[model samples]
Target: MGDAVGRRPAFLLSVVVIAVFGLLSAVANNYGTLLAIRVVVGMGIGGLTIPFDTMAEYLPQTQRGTALLSLSYFWTFGILLVVLSAYVAQQNFRLLLVLCAIPCILSTLVAAWFVPESPRWLLAKGRSAQALDTLRRAAHVNGHPDAVSLFPLGMKLKAEEPEVKSFAVICSPQWGKLFFFLSIVWAGFGLLYYATIMLVTDIFAQDPAERGEADGEGVDIDYEAITMSVVSEFVGLTVVMFTIDRFGRVASQVFTYFSGGICVLLLCLFASADSTSRNLLVVLAFGSRLFMSTGSCVTWTHTAEVLTTEIRTTGHSFVNSMARVTGVISPFIVQGGLPYRTIGVILFIASILTTIASFCLPETRGIALGTAMSQDSTTAKERTGTPNSQEMSQSPATVSDKEVV
Candidate 1:
């Protein structure tokens, strides 16, 4: 929707929908009603890709990874906030939902007043005048008066306006390999990362008799483990902020996932031992979590980088939707009645899959975000030694102004 219309409109719509659904959830009288409303809220959340792609288009390419990874800070903070809110609003869950809408409302107001549509989108649509206006405003705000030089007027662009709505574009030979590979990586990582979190909680759970005693003694959530989990995620993000550009996206992913897999496997071995120590398990869980979080950061940042601007939002939406679906299934896979040792094997396999997928993907550390799909395909083929597809003949050699936006 953002690709067809504009980023600002889609973003505002998402925010409004989320706020409405959130409020509706607060008033929901039944569990079914709440569950249904939450699904709607998830749809609203799908609009997140619009702003993420827009930010990528607007930011300097060199700093894009750093800026995008920094966005994770807000997500981790939100998780911590939710945990604290659960503690505070134990029996007042409805009130908690209502309070959550406040930030959404405020975000809508701020974005409406401040956020601008993507200039790249405007230019692709042939609204050069509007694109120029947006660029000028950005220049003035950034205090870069010479930013106009970056976009020279009347320069002919060879980019073909992509068919953003057609799923066929992604399925075609030119893009299919990359798209399929990324889909696996996204699903596998989401499954492993979420399953591990759930598995750790289950691992630390007390037996039925112990649970009854703990309840009588007022012991509830595992504060130590939860705190470590949240803190390790932040630590991983911080590490990525410094290492992503230095190591490149592909190398970072390969190393993180491979290392994380080993850590999880070791943790499983320790768990399988006759003498299970809580401290040893916690240490191993923390190590696995740190690398998993690091790998997750790389996955998101690199996905945005490698995709072309025309289909960037659509691609992000698809991959994110896949991740969410896998996340929903992860808990069942890990905590399901399967053998306990099987958990480590599952995650270890997922990590190896991610590592292989990372190798298949091209490096995009210093690549220009504004490059077109056609240009990127050529570069990717050269880097990977893959054959160029004849599908290039299908795209127009010269796109006239009247033929595109």
Candidate 2:
């Protein structure tokens, strides 16, 4: 929908769907009705990627990595809030659902009123007049009214050829190899991420006798441990935010996946040891959560940057859907009566594979967004340079007039 109609419309539609279905879910009186409503809510949630695509297109290359990575902080904070809500609502699921719906409702208003369509998307569709108008409006709002002069009044982008379906283009030779490696990276991240959570939860939920603890003593410890793990996510985001643009996306992901896998293996070993101290187990679990959180943030940033703008959202959504599939498969492995060590071994191997896949992806650290599918054949080295250097090297007034049109 974003690729066809426009990003703002698709984003607005998504938030509206979530807000409406989320409220309905709170009032659902039957199990089947709630399940149906929640499924619709999931559909809405899937379209949230449109906003990320919009953000990437609007920002300049220099600030793009930091800006995108900063968005992950909201995810960490949202999780913390959900943890609090779960604690407060306890058995009042309806209240919890209402709390969850509030953010979507707020986001809907913001999207409808504040968000504008991407000028790049407008230009890609050969809507040059509208794209110029959008840019002018943005410059006026940013207190740079004269900046609009950088583009000529009669400037026009060459009309793109009759549109091809994004799926067909992504599956073609140009994008296929990049897409395949990205799918593996995303899927491995998803599986390992959820598997870590399940493993930690399982350990805390063990019977008191099995845990070598007094019957009533585990509850407080469980809450404290969970809180620490959640806090570790913030630490992880901080680490990645500082390193993503500096170290580049590929390096960041490679380090996080490999180190995170080791943490997972150590966590499993300590968890299964009867003589291991609880403090040691908690520390290892925190380390695992921290590394996984870092990997997740970098993966999202890298994928958004690497794909060309022509099929950016479609390609991103496809790879993310692969992640969702692995996310679904994670629970069965964690809870399907596999030995703890065995589950850990499987996740470690998956992470190692993902790390290898990360190495195969092109570095997109400082390149301008590729505006055409044909640009995919260019080597990463050829594309890599100071951020926005090609355009910024030109005088502002002549930049878009010469290159963009």
Per-model TM values vs. the true structure: 0.84, 0.86
lDDT of 2 at 225: 76
Q: Give the distance in Å from residue 50's predicted Cα in candidate 1 to where it truly belongs.
A: 1.7
Candidate 2 local distance difference test against the native: 0.77
Top candidate, metric lDDT? 2
Write candidate 1's Cα lDDT for 280-388 as tens digits.
8888888888888788878888888788767887788788887789898987877677666787888899899988887777766655663433355435443343333
**Please, what is the whole-model Cα lDDT of each candidate in the order they appear?**
0.74, 0.77
* Model 2 misplacement above 4 A: 145-147, 150-152, 155-164, 206-221, 371-405
- Model 2 agreement with the true structure over 21-73: per-residue lDDT tens digits: 99899999999999999989878877878888777876776677888888888
